[model samples]
Target chain A: MKTSYHKLKNFINTPFGVILLVAAVVFGVEVLVMEFLFVFVPVIQASVPPIAFNFLDAVILTLAVSPALYFLIYQRIHADAEKLRKITESAQDAIIVMDNHGRVSFWNEAAETIFGYTKTEAIGKELHKLIAPEKSLNAFNHNFKGFQETGEGPILESVREVMALRKGGEEFPAELAVSALPINGTWHSVGIVRDITARKKRENLLRERERELTEVNEYLRNKEAKEQALLASLGEGMISTEIGGEIITINRVAEEMLGWKEAELVGKKLIEAIPAISETGNIIPPENRVCLNVTAGACVGPLTDDTSAFVKKNGESVPVAITTTPVIIGGKCSGAVIIFRDITNEKELEKTRRDLLSLASHQLRTPLSGTKWLIETLQREIHGTLTEKQGEYLTQIYKINERMTNLVHDMLGVLRMEGDINPAKIEPVSIQTLFGVITETLGNVAKEKNITLEISKTAESSIDTDSLLLRNILECLISNAINYSNEGGAVLVETKRDGADIVFSVKDSGIGIPADEQRQIFQRFYRATNAKTFDTKGTGLGLYIAATLAKKIGAKLTFESAEDAGTTFFLRLPASAK
Target chain B: MNHVLIVEDEDFLVRALKDNLVSEGHSVAVAMDGEAVFDELKKKKPNLILLDLLLPKKNGFDVLKEIRQSPEWQLIPVVILSNLGEDSEIKKALELGANDYFVKSQHPIQEVIEKVREYLEGKGSTKVGL
Candidate 1:
């Protein structure tokens, strides 16, 4: 949909185009009519006026009209020259017209302004001599001779640039276009000149800017490629995530660490990609996620506190020391980088250390036991009967020997717990039956002190516990009670169901631990001053070993006592379901 | 008197055990390691064997494996007396056809001798992998 206004705009944009088209059509029609007239006149000449008469008539007519017609044509030519002069004077480009004799006929105002010559000084003068450089004057004259013959030379037929000199003898760049016109049977050449010095300067500046831009682009590309190569070649696993904890980039080591391809984990939330589970096989709480902490702008170092393992895509756990740092950009946290390494080999080496310890302990025990047996068999008179004083000395030897044995046993037991061995086999266990076995095992020892061991239970139900470990726990508690109790004192073993747990208490009427020493009772080899004095023969590892074994079996062992008051040690273990 | 074979590496322990076993009225033979034990077994068959686990040459498990695999020696009673008291080790020894298992440090000479006498009388029994 073109409006009338748009049509007028098109016509104005190409103002000279329509005029040239109309001139071209009129010229074509005139040439055709001339050809037709020439042919018809030749054929009809006999019937028409005689050739000589016609020639005389034409000559007379031409002679009559010559002066008047010449005046009229001269007036018209002068008017057209005036019109061309006005047009050329207002144009931005310089216009110079020269006759075939190489003499300048006309110079427009622009030509005068450009060449520093007035029209009076330029007209009727040689054009080459006025404007051409001294060095180009000979070539310009040579080309001018050829141009007159054919009107087909470089300067006459087409646009071209030539060395041009100004009035001050200075040379500058210029754009020149030349065309030939036949006016009154002579070839006249016109040149349009545009000074291009400012255009050339601007073009050079643009080229310099483009070169600098290209070099800067190359430098940035190389820097980015070097950084990427460095990240890829690292041995420590590196994962860079967005500020929201979504994974954005992963290095080669990170792919191996997480057991996933980069495409599988990138753009996905880190927590979802590598689900960090605690050693207890439960998901770590969101607050504990190192990735999330870094995303919140907190710096984190390698975490060595709680054991955390990552769940791989294959559902296997890989222990790791995960640390993260925020990738800060302009004082704002844009993302975070997580670096980690697999700890499997470290874990294996730790196990090897434990196994080594066990091996050394095993070797140490054999000789220690041999010494014990040697001392015992000699004292018992199995090899020889001991005298009364020898018996007294042997008693001391037996006590010391027993203490060493207990210490070794306790040390080994603690090591086993540290090494995570001897797992509990949970089953229904009867407190009544355990009490029976304890009595049968330690009854004679209790009898030596006239201690009465009694058992009372409100209910008889088995608990979920390792039978042997529970037996050892009871044996430690009741024996400890009996040994610490006064002669003729009663030691009570009580058991009852308390909600989800079974509470078993070994209450002893004994010389109790001091209030000051109660706090230190659970520590290994710790002894109360009074107990150390009262019983010259105790390892003081009874409670420590009991407490440790209880923890190993997921039980709670607690106690309450006062100085010289009866102490009660309670063992609460989770009861089995019906 | 019943004949007993004692396979132990500890010099002091071997002396003490020999003394105790001699006093208990049982004839005793000694093997310093698993290889010696096998060689001694081929030379002379004892009524019972007290095999220590940690050996200098072949380990006790390999020796036990050999004993259980052989037709003539499979039925002979083997009592493992080891200082390595870990349950997994004990389980492995029993699974390899041990008649009984004992930690030397945990047992008195009298208890060990009593065990040796019981096995010598052909009364020894194992609860599993018999």
Candidate 2:
């Protein structure tokens, strides 16, 4: 029951309930007066006519209810007006009211704070002229004319963003919403304005970041395209794999070489996608694969394995020279890149060259040998006797034949060295015995030059090496020493041990190599200018063959030379030859 | 004097070798081609055979193989005198039962004669002029 009474009291506080209550009170008063007159004032009611008595009752009802109704309705309206004023005063937005004359009628505290003006200074002032930017006044005035006449305009009753001027003459962005109000038959506008500077700054920052992101995205896309073009332009077949040996990318050449499409090979393990076979026709396992070793970081540098063949998709094998390099990023192995080329044509060409070299060697040496034998027969006087002059002529002919033979031998040696024929046959070669044989072979040549060949054998230990190659190298060095030495000059063939390695030094007191030409001393057909002047018969291939043979035997050949002083050629053989 | 057989195709080289052998007091017999070697061996068992690799009818390797296959010629010392100086060719010739190998240009005729004389004297096999 108490809750119902409270609900009724709350409803009576509304404007519609107040009106209904007033009407009920007024009716009650009218009824009570009419009943009182009919009951207690019967003489007056009987003396007057019925219609006139009704009129008198109506007058009394109006007189008693008019003051009470007026007082209650007026007090309620006054309190509501005061509540509205308080709400507008405390609002965060600037609440502004303008009269129809375009003057500011009321301004809230927010307006004072926003426009840098007190309410007293803002009121009664032309609102547009006071707060609108100077450049915006013309448009404001134009819109205000229509707003004043119809109390309606495009800017009225709708929110808009506008440039607002502060009292200090600074400008800022603002949101303005205006609604029309009419009081005393004149139009007025109440506007709510909010400052939007901070919001505008945040929006601009977001736009700038978006533009930067777009530019970076465009740059990356172009860079990726350029890299694709470069990869496609390579002549050799290329494959890239992740660190785990999974194929990441394969180029067009690689696709054609393997007979596998890029899509089919990508994301597959390298060893599975393309199987490598050894020369013995055995499949190379994953542990021995070059690309996998590189990707797994087990290989330190670029490795080239040319003795293996890769089986194509069609099950045909192609011999290839594959070079695998690890991709290192930030000191870590990230992936691997394998570059390969089909060496079938190269292998065939090499075989053809070897055949040609062999044929040439046989053909050229046959005639040379025939000449040598005929000259030797004449010199030996096997068929008949010869005069001293005829013997001298035959000896000259024999010497020329011998030179031609040596030239052919040197040429063939150079070709064989380049062709990489005949793997080394390793054996224990005594240093003393090797030097003895080389010095004996070159003894006649030293005798021709009247040069003394001295042997200083300090190293008696035998080294494991290819005996033939070691003998050839030592013979060339000794002969070169004798050939370049002046008459009576000494040629010392010395040998000693230097920390597990045997060093053979051929020191010659001869016309040493020129300083500038020493760098190219080992080059094929390259003779020092001074040596060429001294000996016209030198083939210049001796040292080149020696150097190549040294490399083949895993030895190091170096020399020290000074002009006219002497040259010492050093051959350092490792204890364990590769 | 022991009889020696010269199996060679080159006329000039054959003449010089025959004349030198005759001068050395050894009976000289000639087989111009590989096919005539058996014919010459049938007529007389030469003490030594100087074989030249490049021949008209059959190469020296086939001749050497056939010679080793025959019981009568198997005991004869056959020396290879070829201008093919490659190690592989030399090794092939030696592997085919050549008693000795010599690159002709690298060795003098006197050295070859000395080798033939040594073989005729019944000395054991020796590899030379490698």
True contacts kept of each: 0.44, 0.66
What's candidate 2's i-RMS value? 1.7
Instruction: Give the alpha carbon lDDT tens digit for every residue of A283-359 in model 1.
Output: 88777775677755564533232268888888888888777777888977788888888887877877797787669
Give the range where candidate 2 chain A is weakest over 10 consecutive residues by summed lDDT: A48-57
Label model 2 with its docking quality class: medium
Task: Report lDDT (Cα) of residue A70, candidate 2.
Answer: 57
Q: Write the per-residue lDDT of candidate 1 for residues B74-123, one digit (tens) a residue.
A: 98899898888776788899988898887777666777778788877767
Worst 10 residues of 2 chain B by lDDT: B121-130
Binned by DockQ into CAPRI classes (incorrect, acceptable, medium, high), candidate 1 is acceptable
